[model samples]
Target: MVRSKKTEDDHIKVAKDLLLASILPNVEFDGWSSGAFEQAVIDSGVDISLVHQIAPRGAIDLAVAFHKKGDELMMHGYKQENFTELKYSEKVMQLIKLRIQASNTHKGAVRKGMSLFALPQNINEGGQLIWKTSDKIWNTLGDKSTDSNWYTKRTTLSAVYSATVLFWLCDDSDEAIDTWNFLNRRIRNVMEIEKAKAKIKKTSFGQSVFSFFDLLQKPSNEHKSGFPGYKG
Candidate 1:
């Protein structure tokens, strides 16, 4: 009997998850290095060749998988919450907090993942991952934007998320209260920027300028294309 592609993919995902579980303890010390991957292969008893096939870039691939896993967990928690009563900014703040809490137990792994992604060669991938997280947050919050605001919103949120994550990693305060406060401040800063834009739009000159730019900027149909900010 021939196995289906979906079956094969599921098997690979399981293998990857096993490897990730086995590597977490080591990641704190090795920072997603080849040694960590090798150790995980031995610990997981997953076929070495299969492990390589699943993660060609070795532990770096697992690091990416770990980040994505946190996103999944965050989204799951988001769905469980009652956000209807919260303001939009409060909802966003809660989402960010949830995302951070998703990885609270694995701060060591997260810290190492940050170091691994901070490498010059991996910087672009790191940025893309953060942008993906921001996009996920906006989509979950029901953002219907298809214009340049889509890009701007994700860009601004990405900055906030990145800064919050860094602050969170260093937060040794009681229950990370400091980090939450910092996140609130960042969200308020973004809100203030939005308020400023609203004020600008109220002016005749600002309206004319925005109208001209709106005409020049084409809406991005991201659903049709895989690229997030593609405007075609």
Candidate 2:
């Protein structure tokens, strides 16, 4: 019997998951190197040819998958919590914390992934992943801004998230209180910038400048047509 496309996809997903699980301990030692990938294939007992077919970029693909899986876990955890009473900034803080916490078990892997992505070739990919995480957080929090603010919000939060993750990786504080405090400060700084922008917008000169810039900026939805100059 011929398997459907969905079945083939499902099989590949299972193989990837198995390989990912097998790779975790190895990543702790090998830092997502080819050696780790080879060991993962052997440990998973998956055929080498099939592993290559699924992960065309070898361990790089697995590292990307690992990052995406953390995002998925963070989203799942977000659904289980009650953030109705929290302020927007607090909600943002909690989401970032949740995302970091999701990878607590495999911090070694995260550390290794960070090193891998920091390479010149992988930097853009790493930056994109950070932007994607920020986008996810904002979208999950029900941000409806389609204007320049959409890009602004994600850009600011991406900085906050990246800084927090780096601070977290180094934090030896009890219960990581230092990292949380650091995150709070970063969020506060962002809030202050937002407040400054609001104050600026209230001024006549600021309004004129913003108006001029707004004319030059397109809404997020307009980028779907593949415009060359629209930077979103």
Candidate 3:
């Protein structure tokens, strides 16, 4: 029987889930390749050939799927909270925290994956993954930025997240308390810069400078495009 498009997506999604579960404990040994995925398919009681149809990129595909699972888990928590009522900085902190906490279940697999991505050949995809993550976080936060700010926000958050994840991987501090503190400090630093910019933009000199700067800025960037994604 031929499957509908929706059915195909559903089938692929279920297979991805089973692959993730099966791969999480074994990715370190197999390194997220087609061989590992084949085992996962077998473990899930599905035909291994389906992997070629659903996700042909092999390890990279599985890694992306794994990362998105964390995004879904994080988004679930974002939905459960009074996120809209929270201050913008608070909301961002919560989003970051949620992502880290969600990864707790498969940190080991992620750690190993990180090492794989760190290789020179794989580094490009690694960077893309970080951007994808920041995109997912912003989407969950309802960001609608479409300018340089969009790029800047994701770029900065990618750095912040990359550093934090590396820290969390080796964090010997109790319950990762140090990691949380580190996160708070990073968020606080960003908030401080934002406040300073806001204040500067309010002054006469600041207004003129900004007006000139705006003239030089990309015309498409009419809306402010960073985290909190305030519309101008």
Candidate 3 clashing pairs, residues 3+ apart or interchain: none
Of 1 and 3, the candidate ahead on TM-score is 1
Instruction: Name the runs in model 3 displaced over 4 angstroms.
Output: 1-6, 33-35, 199-232
Model 3 TM-score, all chains together: 0.79
- Looking at candidate 1, the ten consecutive residues that score lowest on lDDT are 223-232
lDDT against the true structure, each candidate: 0.87, 0.86, 0.75
Whichever of 1 and 3 has more lDDT, that candidate is 1
lDDT of 2 by residue, 178-203 (tens): 99999999999999999999999999
As for lDDT, the candidate ahead, 1 or 2, is: 1
Pick the lDDT winner: 1
What is residue 65's positional error in candidate 2, in angstroms? Answer: 0.5
Cα error, candidate 1, residue 106 (Å): 1.0
lDDT of 1 at 108: 96
Candidate 3 achieves a global lDDT of 0.75
Per-candidate clash tally: 0, 0, 0
CA deviation > 4 Å runs, candidate 1: 1-6, 212-232
